[model samples]
Target chain A: AQSVSQHNHHVILSEAASLELGCNYSYGGTVNLFWYVQYPGQHLQLLLKYFSGDPLVKGIKGFEAEFIKSKFSFNLRKPSVQWSDTAEYFCAVMDAAGNKLTFGGGTRVLVKP
Target chain B: EAGVAQSPRYKIIEKRQSVAFWCNPISGHATLYWYQQILGQGPKLLIQFQNNGVVDDSQLPKDRFSAERLKGVDSTLKIQPAKLEDSAVYLCASSLDSYTIYFGEGSWLTVV
Candidate 1:
């Protein structure tokens, strides 16, 4: 069974602060990775996805993640965050064999204004 | 284009009672998924459908939960003899293939 682990449960930061969220998965084969964000009172939307190429994938709203196959990690980073970035972020993995997407325990980010 | 659609945004039912949630996938999407998200946790996939056929349902608790996607479009997830732990958000998602999934505003269920 493939599982995802997110290192942070809750993070408190101020506006203009740089942020990095760690995500590691326990899979060896080819897999697809994703970062999904859920704003307050809103549905979950895809922030970015990595299927095959480019270790570093840039997503919407100045967000980016790097897929490191050696470490089995895909960490999300944002150089500067705003108050609007306060939300819950989830890291997900889809194993190529079964194609089942498994999500990690989410990280609730609070960007203080 | 419109995203996935779910009905009955909220429902409250007593224990051992039955409840159902409906979902309509995005137009032209062939794959649909049903997920259960307990508070403070990420969403878990309960079942997935490729058109009218079941693709994956390994995590579904078959004893009290059942879901069906008929006509390859709309789907219904039913829970009978609901338990207190069953209270969570039922999220419906759809995708053109196996990759990027678009989610709907989940239907919240509270079992009292």
Candidate 2:
């Protein structure tokens, strides 16, 4: 079975600090990667997705992720963090033929203003 | 568009009781999914529906959990004889094709 792993359980960052959340998946076949964010009381919102294009995918709110196939990783990163970036981030992966997604244990990011 | 819609934002029930949650997918979406999210964990896929037919339900606890998409528009997930461990947020999502899932405000269930 496919599974996703998020190494960082919780991340605290000062304003303007660079952010990176590690995500690794256990799948060898073609896969689709996605980053989703959930605010305090909001639903999960898509940050970005990686299908077949370039490895680096840009998402809304200055978020981006690079899909490295050899490493089986798709890590989320942001150049500068803001207080509004405080939320729970989840990394998900789906096999080519599977419609279901396997999500990693989320990482809570707290950005201090 | 109207993302996805789920009713009963929160539900509380005793163990061995039953509860049901509904989900309305985005307009014209063909694929819908139900996920169970425990506190401090990412959502886990419980079931998947491609229109009115179930595509995958390998993770669903069939003995107590059942879901259906009758008209291919709205879906309902029911948990009979719920247990304390069944307390989680039930998330509904829809996608146009296969990827890019749009999620709704999940239904939180608390099984005491």
Candidate 3:
């Protein structure tokens, strides 16, 4: 079965700290990768997605993710974090068929002001 | 454009009870999806519909779960004889094609 894995279950960082959330998928074939974020009591919002082309894709809120095909990873990164960045992040992948997204367990990020 | 909408925001039901959730996808969208999201986990696809036709229901527990998209517009998801493990947030999403999936504020279901 295809699956996504996020290594860090919980991450705490201070404001202005650099952040990286690891995401890896277990599928060799072509895949579409996505990163989504959910603030407190809010709906899931798309942060970024990699369909094709440039491996490094920039998304909303100063967030970016790089898709490394060799590693089968699309890790999200942010240079400077803000307190408002606190949220639960999820990594998802879909195969070439584009049926349904297979999501990871998710990572809880807490940024201290 | 308005995003997908789902209601009620929250529900509390007893075991063996029947509950239904309503969802209105983004206007003119041809694809719609329903997902079950347990606390601390990502959303799991329950069923998908493409203009009133079932696209996939492999993950849906059809024995007690049923969903329908009539007229290829609004949709409804129902669970009969709900179990405790059924407690989770139900999410509804829609897409123009298939790559981009926009989700709505989920309906939280708590089966006690």
DockQ of each: 0.72, 0.82, 0.83
Give the per-residue lDDT of model 3 (tens digit) for A18-47. 999999999868899999999999999999
Tens-place lDDT digits, model 2, residues A1-113: 88999999999989999999999999868999999999999999999999997999999999999999999999999999999999999999998975779999999999999
State the lDDT of candidate 2 residue by residue for B7-112, as single tens digits: 8899999999999999999999999999999998999999999999999999999999999999899999999999999999999999897787899999999999
In model 3, what is the error at residue A34, expressed in angstroms?
Answer: 0.2
Interface RMSD of 3: 0.8
Of the pair 2 and 3, which is ahead by lDDT? 3
Relative to the real complex, the DockQ score for model 1 comes to 0.72
| Tens-place lDDT digits, model 1, residues A1-113 | 88999999999999999999999999768999999999999999999999888899999999999999999999999999999999999999997743678999999999999
Q: Which model scores highest in DockQ? A: 3
Model 3: share of native contacts present?
0.78
lDDT of model 1 at residue A60?
Answer: 99
